[model samples]
Target: MSTPVPLPITWSPRRNRLVLLPLSAAMVVLFTVMAFVLPANWHLNDRVAMVVSGLLFAGVGLMLARPRVTADEEGVTVVNFVRTRRLAWAEVVRVNLRAGDPWVILDLADGTALAAVGIQPAGGRVQAIQAARTLRDLVDERAVPQDGSTTAQG
Candidate 1:
């Protein structure tokens, strides 16, 4: 039988929109200042600067509008505005969704853990717990730990 895919239950940034809003606003302010503060005599340079900065700002807005997520036969891929990562199903060792700060913890063979942020459900505690458990089971079933172990037999 074919193995099931490890899909991404949720995909988002560790820092929320509220957290990035301020920084984005600050960039706008800085860009605006640079664009307008320059002397009018330096017309060409100022115009170019303004256009570039505006394009950058627009790009940021677009990224915010569409946070990225890709899940397939292998595993989940989450793209935060700054970085993107593809996690393979076998590499994901565990998913820990705890109270107060629910997260998917990926345990690696090298004793490393990667916390997948932004997969939390909107429901109350019970729902979160259930989701966490489900993720855990999925990862557990697929992953093969080290110690020269093999999960499948011919």
Candidate 2:
């Protein structure tokens, strides 16, 4: 019997959380402050627009940081900037994170590959590789054969 992996593991991009988020926050604050401190000739409406644009910038940054993957016994959920996808263990045939690739890719049974933006090397190559291995193990564990033909006998 294959040992069961612990359920409910989550993976997120460390770069987004640690680097992008803080930079976004700092930029937002700076933009807001600059809006009020601009030249006297600048109209009040222009200042408001500047602040609004800054808020929008933060929104995009937050969206980028939102990507994550939650894995459980049944399946894995991939949440990206604008979309979320759920794949059952059976649907995920393989997980690949090749060099220069932006994120993990899930090869499905239907011959289609889905980008799993949640796991990216931008955070750290080591962490991303580890996450891919964990996910790959989960998928392989559930891919047991119905017959024992592949089992080796000592």
TM-score of each: 0.53, 0.83
Clashing pairs in 1: none
**RMSD each, Å:** 6.3, 4.1
In model 1, which runs have C-alpha deviations exceeding 4 angstroms?
Answer: 1-42, 62-69, 118-134, 145-154
| Per-residue lDDT over 31-75 for candidate 2, one digit per residue giving the tens place of the 0 to 100 score | 899998999999999999989888889888888888999999779
Top model number, lDDT: 2
Q: In angstroms, how far off is 138's CA in candidate 2? A: 0.4
For residues 1-154, write the lDDT of model 1, one tens digit per residue: 4455455455444344555566667777777777777777878777677858866885686466344444555675756546777877676766766656754555655578765544544334565566566566666666766664868733
How high is the CA lDDT of each candidate model? 0.61, 0.86
